[model samples]
Target: MHMSVANVVIIFSIFSSAEPYSGQPHIVFFVVDDLGWNDVGYHNSYIKTPTIDMLAKSGVRLNNYYVASHCVPSRNMLISGRHVIDIGLQHGEIGYYPRGLPLDEFTIADKLKEIGYATHLIGKWHCGCYSNHSLPHNRGFDTFFGYLGSSDDHYTHIIMSNGLADLRLNDECVGYKYFGDYSTIMYANEAKNIIAQHDENKPLFLMLAFSAVHKPIQVPDVYMQYYKSTIHDNERRTYAGMASCVDEAIANITEALENKGMLKNSVIVLTTDNGGGSVGNNWPLRGRKNSHWEGGVRGVAFVYSDLLPMDVRGTENSELMHITDWFPTLVKLGGGNPCERKNLYGVDQWEMIRGMEPSARGEVLIALDTTRKASEEYRTGPFKYDKFDITTFAAIKMGKWKLLTGDSTYRNFWDMPDPEYGVIDDEDFDDTRMVRLYDLVDDPSERTDVSEERQDIVHEMLAKLDGYEKAAVPPQMQTKPRLDNHVLECMGPWID
Candidate 1:
């Protein structure tokens, strides 16, 4: 029997209200790397993402969700539930350098573990792996089967930039054994194995962070056949194949969950770490990955669970939600208190997610890069965007207004190379203003700079940035040590 959405909402309201922490739900979080807005089949019909599309169809689509512009910062927020500035990662992402998410910060997995959930991390531990203290197992997970670096080759399982193996099972380097197996399949098999062998008595917290649809654009030839005729560009064609592999992996993982009798008591969250890269598409939205634009930080995210009220299922949530909120949200759902840790920036949005209340937050501090020095201070009077030099490159979203100051690394809008999706207009972007402001409520594409017209909002956002700047700790970036014999051996932390 099917109930109408209106009827379900009324019935739910009459019968039940938001409840306190009740029971643990198996949490399966999928963090896809560099997934674009238009990459999913639900967003863009041209792409074939049947699994994700199907899940999204039954899930609560987060239309106004936000994350950091880069991978490490985003992953840091996800794990620690703290902002980049608070965590001293405001400058940039951790690369080959020896640093990671702070050791003191309690992770989401750690909180879940406190409530007796068996936590496992299956791919891309980009939060930090500069030392044993920063590894996934140390952070909170009971088991970790993934690489400990930023990116790696899909099949070879090697960090191609330095030609070092990265595949690992717990602490042991195992990239040598899985030379030809694709990461999408490899990770899927690992997830299924974890699900199959798990003890049903304990709840599961499986974080499957896929390295798919990222760089190198590598996938099996069979997957590429799905997009051969539709996508013309070689890179995009290959990217589509990689996306398809991820979709199939999700399908298999979900089936495994069902087989394990976990699906009925599961909460599956699918989201991208950041925005898409050069090869990806975020059409009609300004800028690509690493930019302070909507395309860069506005994540493609959704939450699917049988626990969600029927009224909210398949509905789009336009309320403001940040990646950090997941910490408290999941922790509370697992019957654990998030307030046990101090200085947490995340707020529990469990009620909001279940459609029982409005969003817990109204504003989000997108990113703060304090490395760049401005020529002059922010002005109070009628200021020209060019005249006022922004010392800190930052972006903030409050209510309807969104503000960006200083240089956004990549500020150009990107569209799919195909003609039908959309075409990039050379004359569309003038690229003059560094201090840019847009009413995201109206101008999500970030085409117009409203800094001149809206001085009040500008001052408000600037004050907010100033307050955050005063509280931010110094960045933890260290000098890239000379690559020695030890570095050539594997990709785990060399400093341990």
Candidate 2:
């Protein structure tokens, strides 16, 4: 059945105390799929995101934010506040039931609901997408009204693997569910409905993780036309349209909250799981979705609430943050201290959001993989140490000196020519992924290497990395049954 993609506003609001920062307010999170640091309007990208731009303009922009280099690890880390190895998925591949985030691990929803908040998940629940056993309904969420896997066919809602429907409401198995509904629009409507029907007496936590700009980049025609003129490549244009749709959905969600007078107390978290993928724009950064380069982990992030100190509003924050930080921060915001738990790897940064401290976070443990044998990375202050399985990609940085021990794929990573646009030469393909060093501050483009000139700094940075590599979590070798190509393609690559 085809349904008009209209803005369906459900007029129910969970009545809450209007007082500013009174206890817990509504929490709406929009974690878009594969949205790059340079994708949004606020980043001066051609892609139009008036809503996102306005949100950044009115909210706090996290200029130095980061996420995992890919989806599965990012989502797992974000939800569990545990590193992938501790959670049993070291690399960014693995999304299915049983293999998903372990039930034992506490989630943000679990924390919020414990403190009298009604939690709901209304989009891609990629953490796990199998039987009802591992779905959001079984998780901390009071309600789950989205897909079980990653990117579903936006219109058909088909998971495409096993060629079955992927859409769901609560827990019933999807069978061509919500036919003809543009997923971006459908997800937005669902979010608005949840906001309306929410019991305002308790705070609301809605995780609206949109499958925007993800692969199989399907978007509605009306949306596609909006970006055709600006985006040249047909594939990229389609991707841009999808991103545009997600931006619109965010705007509508905020509007619905505003209409109910819930915007005042709501703290809306806007971010993406990882860097841009296939058609995503990560220009000026090094690599794409899969690489651990800054392009993959640096995400477009922000937090907005009317209650946020007005002075900090629209201002850029330099405090380093990770996707996992939100888990503890939101818990603290809900009047509970998640960081108090010894098991959690996340720290509470609610004070940073309040502009009370310059940074509670000192270093970032981005990833430690034993997947393709053993490569890890840690970012402390201005320095980032990256040790990759491939000898050609090892790197360490301190201040302006970036020491790369392998052939750096800085330029050739995004070498694929778009379908609409013809091929381009590989600028970074110097035949060998060899040792190269570049000062990021001076050459944000990563075009030069000064490894020999800064041998002293390289030695110190390598020594610092020696400690991190030794302490890095080893990859877990647990494996589970595989699903159809369609299903596993989007989820994390499973390992047993």
Candidate 3:
């Protein structure tokens, strides 16, 4: 069913009446890139982040939030209340959907706009390209100010705003220059300007997606100097500095809100697109981004609202929530109902945020694959069930019992394969790999394999995993490998 442009506008206007705001609560979604679990001050990092720490202290911290192991998929889940697989986005396919989000699908931004909120998206929009029919403007946002492609040099930024190209600087598109050494600073400035000049009569929904601390490793002199003397490794030092810059930007945003007297009436949510990058420390977790391990998918998340009261502040929630939950959560908060036409995988977390009952949501399914092969895991309650042999499909963490299917063929912090499991040490760290399980409650680091001792539990979890795969949307055909390369080339060279 295709609606005319005029019809779309009318429908949007009608939805806006659903949430009659004498002054509807505003939303500021601050999404960072490639941030680790313990990289910020609240997470016990050596780096200083006074701003983010304050947000955590004054808000609610989510201890068990999860996202896809990669960026585009996670963002897809975030915008649409469905798993990445359900939308034909899996295994880090950049620009997979050339078209923007489907028109039939409803988004948090769309729901907010229905209620008279002015929706805006600024910064990295990796969800799709500008030519795609689902650009930010078409997806219900009133405005868009950011780059269509992913990862660019901070010094020379390439941005697309409101479906236009080569945006003007002082009435001229040429000689346009980006101001800051970091993209975080530029995004922060745009957000501040938008907030300051916004019509106070209408509530706002600003999606501030920062492309900081992702790659190409760039940082300001002040931040670099501050971290060089404090952090140990060169790579970690660069990452820490970049993260600090994001914290500073958040400070500027909240301060602007408070000055406008909108802090109490606003909902601020802070989270990363996915897990940490190569140089990150997942800490007590198991794997890095792109892996099925807890470290790769688990992320740091928090929410702050003055309407909720102070005694409820700084509460830690261990509910099982994922990126897909955001769409439903936001829609409900903005006084808009979720579209009931199709099944949505996400559950609204508003009740959880209100310090209500523990999350009834259960069992997150994760899949990883190369061009020709695939592997999957089902995490329910405290157990993880795998498909391949314990060795061919290694690294299962069920509470304290962590099983290594085989030795570490990958170079990671935890080395040494269990000899008792018939997994020997090969030069590349890949041995015949047997299914060896350990009781993690006793050996938290996965040093032993107790699979032989606890056959009943292992079998039960395996059955559960089997059921999840049968119910999940089947995997899609892998797209061409160089799609991301082509996108980068089209965007041209990064300035800095």
Which is the leading candidate under lDDT?
A: 1
For candidate 3, write residues 337-454 as lDDT tens digits: 7666767778888787768766747545444222222233322222334453332332333443444443333423331121112212223322333344556446544445466678
lDDT of 2 by residue, 1-496 (tens): 1222232222112222234667677899888989876788777557677777777877799977778878888998898777675676665454443467776677888888888889898878777654445667777898887776766777777766555566777756553557888878888998888888876667888999887778778887777797766767677788878887887888778777877777777898988898887578776576778766677877889987867887787799877777788888888878876854546767788789879886666556566553443223312212333343334234443444555543345434532222244324456455343345566668765556565577566556656545655655554434665555554322323333
lDDT of each: 0.81, 0.69, 0.63
The TM-score that candidate 2 achieves is 0.83
RMSD of 1: 5.3
User: In what order do the candidates fall by lDDT, top score first?
Assistant: 1, 2, 3
For model 1, the local distance difference test gives 0.81
Candidate 3 or 1, higher TM-score: 1
Candidate 1 on 343-412: residue-level lDDT in tens? 7788888788788998999899998777875544432235434233354578999988899876654656
Model 3 worst lDDT window (10 residues): 415-424
What are the clash counts of all predictions, listed in order? Answer: 0, 16, 12
Using all chains and alpha carbons, the TM-scores for the candidates as numbered come to 0.91, 0.83, 0.77
